[model samples]
Target: MSDTTPRIETERLVLRVPRIEDFERYAELLADEEACRFIGGHMPRPAAWRRFLQMPGAWAVQGFAMFSVIEKSSGLWLGQLGPWQPDGWPGTEVGWALHRDAWGKGYAYEGAAAAIDWAFAHLGWTEVIHCIDADNAASQALARRLGSRVLRQSGMPAPYEHVVVDVWGQSREDWQVRRSTRA
Candidate 1:
């Protein structure tokens, strides 16, 4: 991870830049069909390796990318979530994909909230989006909890172009207002 990479800590999770050591657990998350269904679905080990490397590469090229979500109590890798905007993306986004075991917990929202804060405060991002599949009620709920609503409908880039998603988001000012209300 870069020296400049910021590590964010929530009540029960730690979010840091993706490291090589995270590949094994990260691969496991990608390998689980049900866990990945709303995302890109499951992939073979070799394909998982490539997907694993994308986060670090994105940080190197874009100066920002998803953080590897770690459970603080168990010190285990849970998943990855944070700022992500590759070429031809609809807009700057804060995404989440957790391990099946991490499901039903509040880690996704906890980690993503910190990430969205970082993006708006440090990355100069005016808004943050969550490209959720129409069928992904869980993610939609998470977005709602974060005070986001479907701004529009769009398709992902190549390889996922056929997958239509609801672009849920809110501007930095809106996020701040919500955060304050929560406090």
Candidate 2:
């Protein structure tokens, strides 16, 4: 794997490392009820900061983790999106979350495509997985848009019982074909 951090740019978004300054914007999104519904529910600012500080290290240590998604034109923090390989996970987890206002704009698809592309291109990762809450229709739609196939039905970690989810994945070969066709 390349030691270099891959920077992926979509038409209107920039997927980059999260900094201390991003906490405020990120915290707000994390605390948003609608936005956080699927991702272990809402979290306080302190917990959000703690997670932010640990993400890049996760990426460096495991070769993949969620990254901050920003708007290129305004340089505004939009949300977080990336491929996370959390311990005990079966495959790379493709995840993302955007503030409520950023919804319906196709930002999720744009950011996710770039990050998934980076995962295959830089890390030689053959499969990118998207584990989303079962009821989250939007995310399920987005996973389908990325050409990810549902691999299994699974449950969320502790404190999130009763919330079953679908695990979606796409192989590198499929990703390459999808990207090529889009181009």
Candidate 3:
């Protein structure tokens, strides 16, 4: 009854479930000051695993979940990206994160686009939202690249205010056309 698929490949990255082998690498990235600059502060290794394990259930309930992103050639664990369904959201949301080394590259766009495509194409999702910190310019740009428009600026958790952006997606008919055009 789970729609949680295995690996989904984009142009330069492979989006897949987090394996135990990924813990050390993921922990290293999460612990990096630069990588954690915009998001939550450094996470402990066990906490990271707990967070990763929660994705499958989120996916089962909402039909989409975060995927660990790996570079196809190097097979390095970059970070995570995908659709999330949180409270007060009308639909699923797309989000991304990467290690500092992966910054300035197009991994965010590549992985995010693929997940949006999959959601609209296969999951019957009509829209995707992105909630980003106001100061996180990089993430805002990524949201725009995925064709999302800012919905509002809202508080996240208790302390941070994030800009809420939403992307209206392709209908099945639209997806078919896009697929045909790409082919």
Candidate 4:
């Protein structure tokens, strides 16, 4: 709740920095096979622990990273989504992943839209991309819902270079126009 810490509130969600208490549900999400199918395969708790720290580390060092998506009503960690750009990454990416129980709720779309807005305004990003697997219809549809289109087909950086991805995105100018129309 510090003046410096970034926190975003939507109609039913809270996007905030990763806290130690969120690791349990974060581990659960990472270990869910179906929920994580396209993002990355399931991992054991030990491995999940390693991956779980990345978000907080990113926020501290880079001053930005995927946010912990929280269900405001229930105080639950829904998932992670927001600004991300790792070494050798394809582009400035706004990615998301939610637990299976949270599906069909439009939380991803809701959270992602807000994230995109924040990245452009706060992060000063000219463009944002969502690296989606070709078969990942869910993410693809979500990207479309956010008004992103497939800009190119590209391979990721080391470790993930093998995974084929369709980079979907829209420029900040497009986002501003889109937002104006909605208003």
- Note the Cα lDDT for every prediction shown: 0.92, 0.82, 0.71, 0.92
**lDDT tens digits by residue: candidate 2, 40-93:** 778898898776777778866765678888899998888888878765565777
Q: On lDDT, who's better, 2 or 4?
A: 4
**Candidate 1, residues 113-135: lDDT per residue as tens digits?**
99999999889999999999999
Find the 10 residues in a row with the least total lDDT in model 2: 1-10
Candidate 3, 112-161: lDDT as tens digits: 87877776766677556676666777887776666666765544543333
> Which digits, one per residue and each the tens of the lDDT, describe model 4 over residues 82-167?
99998889999999989888998999999999999999999999999999999999999999989999999999887777888999
User: Can you give the lDDT of residue 46 in candidate 3?
Assistant: 78
Ten contiguous residues with the weakest lDDT in model 1: 1-10
Pairs that collide in candidate 3 are none
For model 1, the superposed segments whose C-alpha errors exceed 4 Å read none
Select the stronger candidate by lDDT from 2 and 3.
2
TM-score of each: 0.97, 0.90, 0.77, 0.97
